[model samples]
Target: MGARHEERRRQIAEALLAIIDLHGLDAVSLRDVAARAEVSLGAVQHYFRSKDEMLLFALDYISERGTERVRRSLGQGEQPPRAVLRDILAELVPADDQRRAELRIATAFTARSLVSPKLADHLRAGYDSLYDVLVLLIRHAQEADEMPAGLDPERTAAALFALAEGLGMQVLIGHRNPRTALAILDEHLDRLSTTAS
Candidate 1:
């Protein structure tokens, strides 16, 4: 019963994600999501008490999916700090169909976060967690002399993260191609390497 219940919620969330992917975020309605999920409106409401609840689930679902992909990109065994950091940032950009869809949902939520306190809190926490990790990675690299000790970990992490997200947004709006965005990210990483003493 528990498994079935969880599966149903995930199913509805996936429908919501798909809707956000194809239609604008403003087009989202419980009725629309019910139609997309091939379930009754009551079914969605039963699983999620409110629209915000549904949206939160969709965010978590997609975030978990992206995390799984990132873990896979890291692969087995310990990789160099540069390799690990690069893989993490590279996965954040919309370099493939899956990532593009994920980014679409994420971008929509980012806008919606302004008015939805629940979503705003969730998004803020997620960003803070990722930022902390990035800062930690930079610190570790500096400790190992992989990155220059002169560079501040917090500032460098912010810059790299901002660059990756900006590139993802650009790709979504067609201002930049995925390949080009990734190339730019790689070039930035290379510059960091060259700066190391």
Candidate 2:
């Protein structure tokens, strides 16, 4: 019963995400989610008492998937700092249709957060998690003598996040190419190498 409840909640979340992706977050409602999920409105209500709850669930679902993808790309066991950084950073880039859609959905949710403090809190946590991972990679690099001695992991991670988010927005708005964005990232890493020495 617990597993079935979890599955149903996941389905409703998926349906909410699809609606947000297709019609924008503003168009999403409990009724729309139920209709899309092919579940009753009461079912959505049972799992989520309000539209905010549903949107928050959708945001969390999307963020969890991104985190998992980053973890997978970073691979298991031993790996170099640069390799790990590249893998984790690659998760932020929209390399294909699915990723692009995910990015779009995240962007929409983030924009909505300006008016919704609850959403802002959720995305803030997500951002902090990614920053923590990036900082870990940088600290590892420094310890391994892969990065410069004076480099501040927190600041560098924040800059990388900004670069990734800015480039992602550009990609979503048709102002940038994924290859070019990647090249920019590569150049940033090269600069870090020079600074480390």
Candidate 3:
């Protein structure tokens, strides 16, 4: 019964995501979600007491999906620290249709967070996790001599994350292509490698 309940929640979240993707976040409502999911309004209400709850669930679901994809892409291997870090950073930028949709949803949630304390907290937590991981990876690279000796891991991690986020927005706005964005990231990584030597 627990599994079944969770599955139902997942379905509802997916429906909400699709709605956000197609109609924008402003179009989301309990009735629309129920129609999209082909479930009764009461069913959606059963899983989520309000629209904010539904959107929050969808945001978390999308974040987890992206994290899992990054983890799978960086599977266990004897890869160089720099190579692993490059893959991790690359995963954050939207390079395909699926990623574009995910980015759009994330951006929408970010805007919503400005007015929703609950969502702001959730977004803060998500970013904190990402920052922690990036800091760890940067520190690991420095220790392995893959990055410059004097570079601050925390600052570098924040800059890298900001760069990725800016590039992603540019890609979404058609100001830049994925390849160009990736090239810029590669150049930064190359500079780090050069500084290490």
Q: Top TM-score: which candidate number? A: 3
Of the pair 2 and 3, which is ahead by TM-score?
A: 3
lDDT per residue, candidate 2, 1-197, as tens digits? 69988889888878887787788867777888899899999998987787667667776777778778866876788888867877777678786777787888788778778999988898898888878989999999889888887998889889887887787778778888888988888888889778834
Taken over the whole model, the C-alpha lDDT of each candidate is: 0.84, 0.81, 0.84
Q: lDDT per residue, candidate 1, 76-187, as tens digits?
A: 8877787778888887788888788888878878888899888999999999999998999888888887888888788889999999989989999999998999999999
Model 1 accuracy (lDDT, Cα):
0.84
Q: What would the per-residue lDDT of candidate 3 be over residues 1-197, giving only the tens digit for each residue?
A: 79988888778888888888898878788998899888899999987777678767777888778878877877776766777778878877889987888888888888888999999998999899988988998888888888887888888889889898899899988899999999999998888667743
Each candidate: RMSD: 2.3, 2.2, 2.1
| Candidate 1 Cα outliers beyond 4 Å, as residue runs | 1-6, 35-43
Considering lDDT, which of the candidate structures 2 and 3 is the better prediction for this target? Answer: 3
In model 1, the Cα lDDT at residue 67 comes to 77
Measured with C-alpha atoms, the lDDT of residue 80 in candidate 3 is: 68
